[model samples]
Target: KYRNLLLPMHMAIRCHEYLRHTAAAQITYKITRSRSIQVELGKAESFRETLKATQGPCNTSKPSMLDFVNKAKWDAWKSLGSVSQEEARQQYVDLISSLVGTEAPAVAAQPTGSTKGFQTLLVSTEDNITTIRLNRPEKKNAITVEMYNELIEALDLAGKDDSVITVITGSGDYYCSGNDLNNFTKIPEGGVEKLAKESGELLRRYVKVYIDFPKPLIGVINGPAVGVSVTLLGLFDVVYATEKATFHTPFSQLGQSPEGCSSYLFPKIMGAAKASEMLLFNKKLTAAQACEVGLVTEVFPESSFQSEVWTRLKAYAKLPRNSLALSKQLIRVVEKEKLHAVNDAEVERLVERWLSDECMQAIMSFFQAKSKL
Candidate 1:
């Protein structure tokens, strides 16, 4: 479904570019599969309008009636009558700029300094704090393979930077919905076994960064978090959440086991039975519940969550950086080796799970159910 919508829009953009009579206007559209359905439709309409205005009209001689894809594109293009090319160009630029939002540059090729062309995350530093934000809000900040790599790199940079505090959060409503299921479908040329191995390796390194992070690692969970996103809180120094936030690890539902050192840390933090309820039985915990279980440091009222968390963080950042770093390192030193072992074990187990029939069936069922919706 996503592919069907994307291919036509991509081709339409290319066609528009090809038909351009002037070099004054050029569009560099960054296509993302994570776009919401409404957003996708809105962009499609805009694209059609832009194409019609700039190109004058769909080539009636081309896109034969039997060519459904091209025909649909033709119909869409025909529906929007042509306008002045200059007007269309301005409208297209304005629309793209608006969609890009203030967080990113309007032109896709524009560089985001220090972030080094990160596609899935927003990394920024301020007031002695380095923030790594999961930016895919339309998909509840789901972590894709690209996101995982970007996160690892971001954390590594943050660890070495002058920032006294490193924070992780999400853009928009969700803190994170956890791994994008679509990540599994993108198997490399070596097949599932190879993909599993490489993914497991990546997961290991991702978790290890958190375990060995030098600065104070904070999680600002503004909304619901799931799977590895929730599990990773075990390695964070502090996890501040909004009152409306929730933490969930639905590993069993996906026919997968625990990761991010959760298998070892969850029981240690919340007690075996409570952890079992979450890790084994897929029980979701509210912000209060999570705090009580030691997964969250504290919960703030949604009305003031941001102001309150940042106020404290800024104050904390004012303290002697080395002292704070040393203190955190001292606290984590004992568990560093333990977390490493747990991470390796979990990754190996996950690799096996990824290649299993049960996991595949569960993922297929999930997609089937979603398609029906």
Candidate 2:
């Protein structure tokens, strides 16, 4: 459906030029932030392919081994193999659309045929605010593999949309119950090794979206948050919680290491000793305690949480959008590279943990205990 919206080759060329100029302009003011090296490389590769799709392949001899950038760009173009030029052009246009804030909605309002709408989230935009609410109340909004993909898509859209602020919360009483353990039980034909690698990659992309979010991201924690849900708050610009809310990351209990760049941000936010009590010892903190320790910005009484938080957020959303976004980019620029590195290291460690006997045993025991209950 979105393919019909592709910009022509000449327009795509102009778009690339525009991006370069905009990036240069923003850099001059120190408001432009660096994306992960991988994302930047991918964009470069896509631009190269777009050129090849319009113009013929590069005329020069193959890039030498020492020319890392040229070699990678050449390889990316070569990877298209027999794909049609039109297809390559379409792919390049899609990439540009995402970067230039022209992406279609993550889920159409009335998707037809095989297109699916969001099943795990309720997304709505109003008054320059996009609220992405986790909707699986029956399961305390636990994140399944499918939800992970939807979240990444939603965040990407919200980041590129005209919204001035993006808010994340949950329906019902729980913000999130953490990862759905069932994700581990359904090993595919390729087995645990393949599953580990794929899951790690997916998780990496999930966290990357949060790290790279352009607009102000606010977390409204109405209830308990666990595991990745708790860890991810570190990426939010501000977090408001109800008196009922609690933050917990029982990673060690599940034989998992920290993720969501929590390993780095947590220490910075709460100091090494307090961060260790939660990340290393699995200490759960009440809303007041979390705020005291710097994990949450504030805690409101449960009775007034919704009204109070929304009122403040609505006021924030009315400010000059560009100023807010550019200021945020500047603040985040310094830590962006470090966050990406921590994310990579954390995901790598988690992949190893997921494949380990200790993690498997711990999970099995957890299930066993649940069954007996």
Candidate 3:
């Protein structure tokens, strides 16, 4: 009884302070402190430290450091997902507030120098280019609901603010791997129906935003693009990559269908046969190969990729902003309704896939594979 009272009282006070100061005061702190969960937390903290250091840009060799960091982060998050979310709300409120502090730091004072409270992205504007980076390299830059909201916010800013162009990229080794499985695992008690409802709503919002983005959107594929990320490349005005970059669509592999309006876009962009190879067989495309196939605009040398890409983009951004916007709009205006319909259909099908036995089996098989069962 004392434990319950103490936690809530402490949290209420702190949360009041938090709510007063910042909006990202939302805290999700549910877990059982089992040995395995603690171990996962330790690993997650370690990866986060490394991720903090990898804020802006860093050089890389053959197998880049980002790749290593991404894998470690994925492993950590995967382990963390094993944690159950059945604890009392008051306990969580108190524990989270105590650990992370009462007041969430203001965006202007973020350690990453980002002017936003993004859990899975690093957002900043320079020379009219709003660069929204996928910050969760630990999970191969997967998209979660929070991350989706952040991305939309960034785009909204780009449309309203003085930013001339917006660029999306990933940290560590990936541009964006796809939707994070961790998001689906959070509602264990609600089962497949819960997963479908939450994910379908989030994904539909994401697809709508992507389809109707008002500003010129560029994708900087720093290393690899996979799943929804790969499909999203079809929507970007331009996609640039490094020599070490790769592209893959694993919809069928995951017992899911194409997303990001790729069901319509892929066939047109890469031809019917190649699209089948990618969607069905999970064919991975190297940077040069992706360039040849029309998915990637250019593949720069790994050493100078970042500098070259940003320099070119900054130069292009300096071009008349209205001209750039109008030109892009002209190119894509015809397909707006088509893409929207496809997005709606895909979301419907995706919900069905989520509830299907095949998807459940595939998810179970994945766990077995990870646990060596």
Candidate 4:
């Protein structure tokens, strides 16, 4: 039995080396012992063999330059047996580049019978209210690159179409869940700055649309309004959330920072202490709590959420469009000028925090535990 002890000791070293390239891999090694040590070692060996086979000359297809860069980075990580601070920086740059380069593809515009023209957002105009449902429910109403572009278009149309007075809701029961995580893996290996710029541009554009739109923007939060989904609500004129709705920001949890100018808007809307609690502490709020904090205007039963929202929208619609638009503009103007600077500062601070060892460790730990579960 003592003779077999050397085998486990050897397995541990092999497992450690194998996991060296991944940020989350070390957490697995830490959480599990002996048997896992052997298993991880075997998996590492398998991975090495698979990688070798894939790179062999007989495989006619060439690996893309970005793919090769990632592979080289991973190999270097394995050879070093640990990621240094410098290596972590390079990895962040690579990861961000990839995220921005391969932003989610656009959806084809659909022809709608409504006079608003073709749009990705499904619009239903009843009386003075326009309900624009985010049509991609299969993906849980997750926002894609194309959806962002289309959202701007929809807002423009809503502004121009006099028949539509109040813009009620866009997404379905789920609302919008921010960028898809699956796409996060495919971001290119360079151009991190450009990527950040583009992402910021899209978000800024959306904020402008929300703030400058001529009528009230009411959000109907039916489920989890996560990441950007949660932040976007800050731009809404009023929000009606179901009792089932929950809001959370997983920026620190996801190895990223708060985006969509929430940092500026949240503090303005909810005050410094409350905003800090939500953004810094990553607090998740229930619909009732959100209402109390002024993030949500009211909470309604999930069973009748749609009907209730429509009732509210119709009430808003009854107001003179010009008067409603003017009131909205005045409120926005009072809060204006400060939001842009605050948003920029917040993102800069968040980016720094995201790059810190503490945040990195937290993110890696969360992912590792999540993977195991």
lDDT of each: 0.83, 0.82, 0.72, 0.63
Task: Tell me the lDDT of candidate 3.
Answer: 0.72
How does residue 189 of candidate 4 score in lDDT?
A: 59
lDDT of 4 by residue, 1-373 (tens): 3123222333234433444586534333332332333433343333333233222112233445789764653563344333444453344334323333444455554334354543456876667676677766677777777777888888778777664464545455676666665432334455534444565566667766765677778787778788887887887888888898888887756667776678777887789998887787789988898898899999999889879777767777787878878888888887666766666665566546544677657756766787998
Stretches of model 4 off by over 4 angstroms after superposition: 1-120, 168-172, 188-190, 346-373
Tens-place lDDT digits, model 3, residues 126-198:
7778888899888888888788888877777767766789998889987887877767667757776987977
Q: What is the lDDT of residue 2 in candidate 3?
A: 21
lDDT of 2 by residue, 24-124 (tens): 23321221232323334345554565655554445457799999977876776565566655565555545544444432234544322122269999888
Clashes of each: 0, 0, 2, 4
Candidate numbers, best TM-score first, in rank order: 2, 1, 3, 4
Model 1: lowest-lDDT 10 consecutive positions: 22-31
Weakest lDDT window of 10 consecutive positions for candidate 4: 50-59
Q: Identify the runs in model 2 with alpha carbons over 4 angstroms from their true place.
A: 1-116
Question: Between candidates 1 and 4, which one is better according to TM-score?
Answer: 1
Q: Which model is ahead, 2 or 3, in terms of TM-score?
A: 2
Q: What lDDT is obtained when candidate 2 is compared to the true structure?
A: 0.82
What are the per-residue Cα lDDT tens digits for candidate 1 across 55-78? 755657558878997787678877
**Cα RMSD of predicted structure 1:** 22.6
Residue runs of model 1 more than 4 Å from their true location after superposition:
1-116
